[model samples]
Target: MPEIKSVPLSRAAAPRPGSASRPSAASLRYAAPALLGYVAVRITGVAILLIAASATGKDGMHRLAGRWDSVWYQRIAEHGYGYEVRLPDGTFHSDLAFFPLLPALERGLSALIPPLGVAGAGLLVSWLASLAAAGGIFAVGARLYGRRAGVLLAVLWGAYPTAFVQSMAYTETLFTALAAWALYAVLTDRWITAGVLCVGAGLTRPVAAALIAAIGVTALWRLFTAWRAGEPLRTQLQMVVGACLAPLGWLSYIAFVAVREGHPFAYFDVQADWNNRIDGGAALAAFVVEQFGRNVFAGLGLCAAFAFLFWVLWLCVRQRPRQPLPVITYCVVVVVISLIGSGYFGSRPRLMMPAFPLLLPAAVALAGARRRTLPAVAVGVAALASGVYGAFTLLGSGPP
Candidate 1:
């Protein structure tokens, strides 16, 4: 079991091999390539996507950059949450459509390096979030599973085509970083810190509700276990605090939006306008059919969703490697809700972004892969192709 020493949130290092035995330089050196490989793939994926967009036309490419959400993030980065946009409907739309954390980070980074307005800030945030995410994944796999799993986790994340989403201004990287760290903290029994981080994550994206829900369940389970064992009253109290963390982000944002947008639920209404509504089977089917016909990346997006379902079942049955049940549960729930509850098919896969960490266990399993290097190469190539699919569409618009 990982040691539980009370430390400040900022002071807490990821649980190591033990309190005494730190990993060696050799271990660090061994991990470098796997980490670098994941990063390289993400960068290449972004470049390819940009090229594809440039070659084709800006319309599709703009969508790839997430004009819908990214533009809001950009708007937020440019101007903090003001909550009043004159919508096509003529009534005001809430800035609450964009959460606070990403813009907060963008503004912070811009203040630090003025040259990095929103785009630069987004890029820097993505890179840092990616690195933090890799670290959290490594810490989770290594501490809970093993060192090999950690290396594989890093490689898998770096090599993921979805990493391209991070390459642009997408909020996945930031949310993942926060979620991973928060998960790590939860596992380590740092409940208050976990709650705070979860709150940050909630502010980053609504999907973070999954992470928060998972952590809340896990914390409750632990509290129950403690009560059964008669551990202590204080531990249970921490559970209460931790349970409160994740919702703070969303609630605060909603409150802010209510003040600015007239209706507290205005964000959801705006989402409906952009095709992000909650509906059942028929609505989702329409989206899937449309996205399948729209482009190749969309098709890959569908394939990955199904692939995740099959793979998760295999993980649950075969290895049953214990880490966070909530992690898997969170993923399954988010995926189902997004796919089914979501009104837009084109948005399903993108909405399924939180499942990115599920790739860690698969990567770990691949540690013993027969052709390890090839999987890396294969994934890298696929990412480049999928990401750049729009670049070809973007460039035909009369630009170099």
Candidate 2:
């Protein structure tokens, strides 16, 4: 019980006897291959986008940074919300549906350096956030596994099917950066930092619910064992207070929406306007079935989509790399929300982007591959595929 209390409840799993400790500068230096691999993938993605855009006579930069959700965020930053678009079907989509932190950062940075502009600032935020997220992922993986596994984890995250979103003027990268660091803080027992980052993540995206739940559960576990562990009063108070702080950003946003829209549940109603609701994967399951029946190939593709998800999940559980409770909880919640949420079936992969823990098993496998060249080759092939897909998606249709 004392040992259990000492290990973070955020990661309720038992710690390995020789789990690597916190990452240091030297560890980061050793992560060069991972960092370089990520950069190479990003470059490939961007290069493909540029080439496709040129062939079509469109501005590549604008397409990547100024369309879809990016436009909505820029509008929010430039005009301070209160915007709405009523679809032909009569559903009103409100800018309030978008969270605030990304736009707020865009607004501030664009103001500080006028040349950067809103879109440019957004891209800057995303690029920087991607690096931060990578570092955090590497740190977490290194601590739990080893430097090799850590590096591979970061690289795999960069090669994710929706990795292109990390380069866009979107909130995904920003939210992921906050989440990775917040989880790291939890693992390291930095309760205050974890709470603060969770707050920021809450402000950036609706999925902050998962993060808050993780923090709250961990805090509760800590409190339950405080006496057995002989925890000092100060530490217990900090743990409780930090947990309390986790939900304020999300609640504050909800309250603001209520006040602004003249209804206590206006935020939820607005989400319904976009068909974004928790349907317990019923909608997702139906979507898969429908797709499968439409065209055999398309159906197979859809099946493959879910198959990939389950495969990663199976690996994570099978590897069971001595993760803490918070990491496990965060990973499960993100997967649930991503898969079970209604509408935006195309966006589900992007939504699952922050569930970095799923990569741990794959990373472990890659790290143990007898032939070092095989991992590099695998990453290269994946990057090429990802780049082509990202370019096609951005150049061909409605924002990715």
Candidate 3:
């Protein structure tokens, strides 16, 4: 595979016998540039948002941190669940459809810091999680490819069109952070860490179902191989334990919803209320084709969007032909769930943010650039475009 090679966890953890016992400083040195680059992109996006808000007499900070899904999360934090808003058209918006982990963290932090409201707490968590995400991305890239590729990987993830969500008081950053680290753990064969992070990711978003599936499939496959190879019973048992634990958080949430709503499948039913369900991309295709009838320009835009996603998926397959089973499974499942599930059309880009594996090919290209200036210019242009899009999306009518 041209993507990167996977290194085991113990090899990564252990230093040469005569070397320093830890690589903390080395990691920081490698990660600092990527984190700074990402934050710079986010700051530019915020600055654009601020200018746009000022010109329109709007509160950009509030819009950035308190509107749309941010508002939903804060509502869940401040006032528990069971809240619903009935639209004039008779459709209902219920808080129950949202996941709970991010809100729970917001609520806890808000209490810990009396001066910081739930929104502020949420932002705090989001920013920190974004940094952690960058680090995890770096770790994965470094282990798979090299440190340079790792740096590019982190920067590329931050340059995503929906990168602003990493800065907002949303669950994307937190979920991505957990998912990246969980994937890293899997790569390193840290079964316990992978299982725990998978649980956390599962708690943060329904998309975590994809992560759980990846972990389960990988663990079970490894367990069977270990059994056939006559590996130690303890070694096989760890895989079983990790796979078993991966889905608990998601299942627990469903049980809670079922109990609260007095139905066995109330969680799925609640999602149906919001027009979110798995329809094998029927709704997505309809959404794209309708754009042509309503507005040819938008139809072109949708075409470009679809083309871009298809290209990324193609790169994922073609560029990394020999990717580790966990990486391939995780990335493919993430794309499948993101595209196949029925949800708000506008939010699809944001939904795709967690599929960080899609960036691997781009990262490899950037990492392999002969002239340093080329990658720099590419990332710079991407960051600028990301900033403009983010500002426009946050300031526009609909939610991002």
Candidate 4:
């Protein structure tokens, strides 16, 4: 592998003179290879899933758009949210725990086209969002590293172990698309654009807190630097405006829930009912220790996996032409949120799907490979493994 070179921070953070932050026709053309590669990987995964589903006499489409959280989203779309379930354990699971953006999209889209039901509309939204996410990921990578790295970064995201979720009727793809573009906007100094995208992300998922924090932190840092440099307030006004706008969507939803439930912390209460409230990793530690009692190898493997996650994160932290402050902040918050939550252990990877920045190290390495065919071979193997795992997990008794 060739060593990856880093650009100076000033060069990395500042857009080239006269270059627009928004993608141009030329930028789209440059990103076409990445988009196509992402599509191909996703298509291959779906193909494998369909073949496996057929062999087992199962409906792949239904599995993709009608299972687990997908059902919750569709229910919200078709009948709006007052749904709840009383579990045998005397706990309640309320639909309000879910964010409303995906459901809203499903309802609107299905209403526009009668032939596509709510579920079908959800699948459509997810599929399209996945493509947009690929484009945004490519743009970020290309800006920081180069076109080749950008292409690999997008493709690698599509070939993630839990990339299967990107195809299902879930908010992961939609949130990721918004988050990726939002980070890109921050990188390019398009403060208001970043904040707008952050608003969309906030409306889509509670994890939008990470994106909100990233934007807030980045804006504060910019304000401080600008002030120290004696830059005028007019130039820093957009940063302040963007930071203010970034949290509104999330705050609005929380306020809505508070009013609806007649409690100040109704949103947190709802999450607690679903057992997803953050516990500072206490639950995660206990779960891992319990796994050791059940099966030592499984416990060891889990520990190793977590170690690997942190190692990759460290790589991101130390990445050459270092990642912008917003990117690092976003990725770190996403990981922390994913691990500290007391939700079902099986869902952690899916929760972390929006943390696409963690894959930067691997993308960089692949881009620096000496053998031209090495990256393609690695991607092929990864896609194959991911597809197999996805089929098994999706078809098994548990939710993925």
Q: Weakest 10 consecutive residues, lDDT, candidate 2?
A: 1-10
In TM-score terms, candidate 1 sits at 0.78
Best by lDDT: 4
Best model number under TM-score: 4
Give the residue spans of candidate 2 off by over 4 A.
1-32, 227-234
What does candidate 4's lDDT look like per residue over 132-231, in tens digits? 9999999888877677888999999999998989989999999999999998988877889899998999899999999999999878877787788798
Question: How many clashes in each structure?
Answer: 23, 7, 1, 0
> Can you tell me which runs of candidate 3 are displaced by over 4 Å?
1-26, 294-301, 319-322
TM-scores for every candidate against the unseen true structure:
0.78, 0.91, 0.91, 0.96
For model 1, the superposed segments whose C-alpha errors exceed 4 Å read 1-31, 49-68, 82-94, 262-264, 287-321, 370-375, 386-400
Query: Candidate 1, residue 342: CA error in Å?
Result: 3.0
lDDT of 2 by residue, 1-400 (tens): 0011133333543344544453352256766766777777788888988998899898888876889899999999999989999999999998999999999999999999999999999999999899888878887787677678888888888888878888899998899889888888877777888899999999999999999998898788777777677867576787777788899889999999999989999999999898998888988888878887888898898888679889878666544435666777788889988988887788888888999999887787788888879788888888888888888888778453
Residue 386, model 1: lDDT of 47
Models sorted by lDDT, best on top: 4, 2, 3, 1
RMSD of each: 6.5, 3.8, 3.1, 2.0
